[model samples]
Target: MVLFVIGIIACEKRLDEEVFSELAPSTLFTSEKGLSSVLNSSYAYAHRPGFQDSWAAYHLASMTTGEIWGQGGSIENLWLSEIDFTWDGNHDHIIAQWTIYFNSIRDANIVLDNLDNEEFSNEYKQLTEAEAHFLRGWDYSELYNLFGPVPLYKTSTDDPLLPRSSESEVQEFIEQELLAAIANLPVQAPAYGRASKGAAMAVLCKYYLNTKQWQNAADVAEDIQDLGVYELLPNYGNVFSIDNEGNNEILWALPKDATSPTASQAIDALVFPPDYPRPNPNNIVFAARTYLYDDFVNSFDENDTRRNYIITEYVSTTTGEIVPGLGDDRSFPYKIEFDPGAVGAAAGNDIPAIRYSDILLSRAEALNEISGPTQTAIDLINDVRTRAGISPLTLAGFTKETFREAILQERGWELFFEGKRREDMIRQDVFISNAVSRGKNAKDYHKLFPIPQVELDANPDLVQNPGY
Candidate 1:
């Protein structure tokens, strides 16, 4: 397996030609090359040891079904419960998530603070600042969405204890940052790993859509579509192939190189099967909650190719294979495989934040919300369905409410395992109660995750959410 090692140069001194201490952020941010290095470092840190755990991806799936509970350890179980949790102040998962989010924020602040210096060009500096804004906004959005009313930090500070911001305040903050980022960012990033205007738009759509500002979300999604640089990949499965790097569908992705020294094993270990005799060392996988439902299984007619691509009844890897008809096999979505190693190995696939499919779905949903499901919405949905080789829904039998349900279900089918189910359910106003009867947790107060105890202990200024 090839690993991509980010070049680490000591930034202790300016190089007329000599390299210096690599660890110091201050030294690194002084030069153009050094500044870029600092940005890469921040990216590296996002996927580093303290940031993502198996729960990062698992939580998204765990909200669904067929996921093993006891296996992820106690933290997973605590999160799975439909009630408020009171974890120890030093719970590793909480601390890890808190620290990494802030760390990325701080790094972005450093970049924004220094990008305009004479050493960098206007274009590069503008792009750098845009990326920083996107990163900061993106980090806070993550915190706010999962754990409502999180502390907000504009500039990095030595004061480790920060207080929580109100949910409205946090949402406003994300929108503001993302808007500015959209303005400064390029429509298409020069590199696969960097943020772009489309990325900003995607985040804006997510931010507005989640907050129920459907009109705003629709407008921004339309803007992204107008960019004309992105499109749905003709082949549904190719979008996730390792060889399909920088495909037009991807708006923003966390660039992953298996060979990179800085890489962490990604969802592969969790998504792929474990200990199958044949595919033994090839794709290590895990099963999660958001497996599949009978409604979904029956929704697609025999000709719908998406059903084949999105839902898998059997687990297949380079190693051994379980017979497809087995009961265990039916529960797991075999689309993606887990690479075995430690608990969470860095899977080579780049994690996509937003892609063309997201825009299409968002537009369809937004149109439904605003104009009550017009032909435009139907066409857009069918566009994606056609790409997936699914039969198009004729407007004849489709009503606004029916299309809304279809759109959401289609999102469930299309975007499953892409870290979106919880948010989708919540946005559609189905999360807090519907999921409960559906064999999942959906208490009104349980909509948002609890504030990690460590944050509260560190700062008396922070208060727990209503339920917690």
Candidate 2:
């Protein structure tokens, strides 16, 4: 599973468009208002309902880590491939994520291509281009995490039929693109959900961590801290609450519209069991359900406020009876709390794509990996621990190995259901073993999901991943 990292220190980091489909690129590129709408379209696709609900990170990745299970839906999802590790190219979640990444990239390219339009001022054009890069880089990371080196559609003109890029090319592209984005994005975003320096750098830090570029990862973490705009909010439970969407700790998020929220982003559809008493009587629980694996629920120290999201026992909505979580079966994920103003099941909670706490944890792990455990690493971890209402770990208690394991556990506790656990397990080299230990049929090759069968059929030049 070792990947070759090229001179990434030298190099630098898409989503949907609406009018893009209806109008010619030339026509759409003419006016400032027209161009702006195209850019907004990209955001819509990138931050669409599936982004938060159960696309890639939320289900496909988390399920592989043996942390959660999905059930009760006719619509296909990773739930189809959840427990057995039997998903193939046709897996619904796999195809959905693949489409999201490529389509997102396409839209970003559309925006970039139109940046030269004279209607917008030069400064506005530069900002627009940077925003395009940030989104394109974000989707690229999503694709790389799930599928390794996918076909590198660097821009819209890159042959649609081109085969996969070399791992190094893909890695370098991600780094260089993000570096460009970091250079252009402001320290503070002009508005909510917009990518900022912190968001772009957090992603670069993530790429560095996954590639095992320990020093680069640690360095980016420190750079984010230097921005002086981020900190862990005092309470873990409130971070994801619907009422606290754009709080200080959230570096960047996929925000829901206040007036007309997304229907598919109904995350509570999976979290609340049929009978769990929802604080909002108006919310609709969809057929889909997500239950925490009992072991994951039990792994947390009872004192960790983060554990508050795991609803183990609740008053039943219909029977007015108390229902206990079925061991290893039905503990719920209440991360995106019930949204009373919801369109149906969707919540107003802005799904956090990157957070301040992630920077601290990533830096701690990277430092430990680079030079073994250190006081700086310990303090970074303690920052998260303190916010979670848990006791801090002493430097004396951990060696490199133990610190690595502890940080991995801390990540699970603090960031589970936030779409980061798979990378954590993979970076820690336990992705497959954790599955096997839990009696799953995982293999080394299973670390990367197979390229979708439809993608292979449509683009003859594309090669499928090994063992698919």
Candidate 3:
């Protein structure tokens, strides 16, 4: 990780003097090489707080979404808050998520604020601006995904008492930032992990979809299709393979190092059973284990290639025999690609931020919302279904409502454990009801997480969500 001290207000509960340190007038900005030295910090900080970590990715994203939960593990107690829909401002993961996104946003702001230095060459300035805008937009979108509209800080701020923006206000901000990114971002990023025009457009689609702007969402998704730069890999498993980290299907992914602990993902520890043996010697098991709800795993069709990734049974390392993992130990979520060799749960699997399949699904749903079930929508859905080795749905299948239901289910199956579930259920208007159906005490206000308690206490100007 780059250790440059750029100007940023670290999004902690408390504001300290060091949080407002400046990046200007530094010798590091005198040359292009020096500017490049500090650029990785933006990507590193953004990627670190999301996909590479389990607290925000699995705990808040998947556990609350009704399909997945933890069983016997050290972190099971922590998982209960989200699993039961009892999370609040005081929840540890909620607080961490709020801090995480803002920290990443601050990183982007630091880079953006310094890009204008005359000492630095203008050759790379435009790319740097696009990258910063993309990261900021991505960070804000994720923040809006969890809490409705958080305290909006477009630039680095010494005053940490900014109030939360309105939902429409935040949405417009994301749209503007993404549009700017799309204008300058290259069709293909210079590097695998950098932001591209496709990434920006997909993110804009997400912003529109989440805001229920169907026309805008569908239009942006169509724009991505026109790019002709992305496609689904023939095999779903290989899409996430360490060997295919930046494959054609992926619009954006958080790059992970195979051997670096801080630079890799911990999915194996959170989802795999401790005693289960892995095929590769490098993929060692960790103690943390999350269970696949029996109902959800059973919901998958037997022919689904996607279901094969969810291990219902596994060979126990200690016993040297196949064990009933489904109702016994725990069915593991093996969706995130595991590295053949790495330390503990930190594997080289680059976490996907968005895939071409997501764009296809988004366009289909948006079209469905705009009109009724159209042939175009069905064809788009089939593209994803064909890759999954499942039977395609014809136009004669059903009415508008049924198609919507099918789209939601397809997304649940295809995007499982990729940090999209929580938002998916909410957008489908089933997040709270789905939990209530499963005996959780979900309330209307539970749709959005509360602002972190520390932030509220620190800034009285910040208003909390409807319910505490």
Candidate 4:
């Protein structure tokens, strides 16, 4: 299996002449071990580093909103540019993310194409195929949201050039893939990190939300709640605690292990205060460059237990004195807390991509959209508020518009710094307006990021997203 793993790398590489010349799919997918290795490689792209420190999708999503700002330092301009909506197609972050998503899709396709290759048992083949479909759907979901209609590759191909699919076509493809994945995936994965029926349902719920399919979103979310396998953790803080990696609250998360390079999340090292204590000799300081915006800090009620995760001040390592964080420097998200015992950037804290709380919120939003304010919706919102130690909302004179606003705000407060802010803002149609209100020169065209210039250059069929 160890020797065959090299062939897995070739199978997962870019669909170009060099890779095709180097290795064929027959060489890698000839056995269960080989197919499994390539499938694992596909999952690796799920958490590409965004800038120098933060996860790319999470960082870009967080920075674009008014909730956060890049603390001034190295690559400060780059971060600020994204927040200001000034980044172009050539931005390295944009290019890197584009490659990650497409490469992930390609890798998933490789496994899907070879699933029937007679080298694997029926049980192993079904499970691996389900995992591949989920990965592909997940990657496409991210790519579709960020870059608009990207070239849809259903199978591995020798042709490097492809045209973009219509948004509707891509959406339908994602919907079908997720539906198929849901059928094959178990209600709960054998391990915390693997895909499951709940994960596929969660993704479908989000897709419905994104496409404004209100009733479908509501129904699917309700289906997830009815699964009876997930719930909100009693303590809000523990939800992100390293020890609570696979708590019931998490629907799907990227599993991290301190000793496994591929499994660890470096987010803690990137978010920890610059001078904070470290376990080893590495000067892995990326703290000051990313912090919560003052407005976001003030948005929280003092009694909200979730506020405990957002650090407003920290004691200096040099002076042993308390220092308050202010403005962009005032509040740092300590959500992924510093791990003094971690080796290098490897912090053993699983990053939740979808959680039960998120499903609850999305369901509430969809219900409100469908039938105004209903008790079921209010109860759903209240469930999350209660967990956050905040007073729950009542039905007293609640209009649909007001309830919608409240739910959106609730999501912002609950899911801050978790990489869903940008998507939330866009769904609520306030993404550009919020930036403009905060003095950013943002325009409507900034809603979707520019398709990377590198992609456009290599593929003649590609067009730069409008306003690039």
Candidate 2 lDDT trough over 10 residues, lowest sum: 4-13
lDDT of the structure predicted as candidate 1: 0.64
Off by over 4 Å in 3: 1-25, 29-31, 49-55, 280-282, 327-329
Candidate 2, residues 91-174: lDDT per residue as tens digits?
A: 877888887667767767877887776567988887878878888888888899999998877676777899899999999889
- Every candidate's lDDT: 0.64, 0.77, 0.77, 0.77
Worst 10 residues of 3 by lDDT: 12-21
Residue 408 C-alpha lDDT in model 1: 88
lDDT of 1 by residue, 198-229 (tens): 88888888888878898998998898889898
- Model 3 clash pairs are none
Residue 192's lDDT in candidate 1? 55
Candidate 1 clash total?
40
lDDT, candidate 4, residue 367? 93
Q: Per-residue lDDT for 30-66 in model 3, tens only?
A: 4554444445556655665333353466668888877
User: Which of the predicted structures, 2 or 3, would earn the higher TM-score when compared with the native?
Assistant: 2
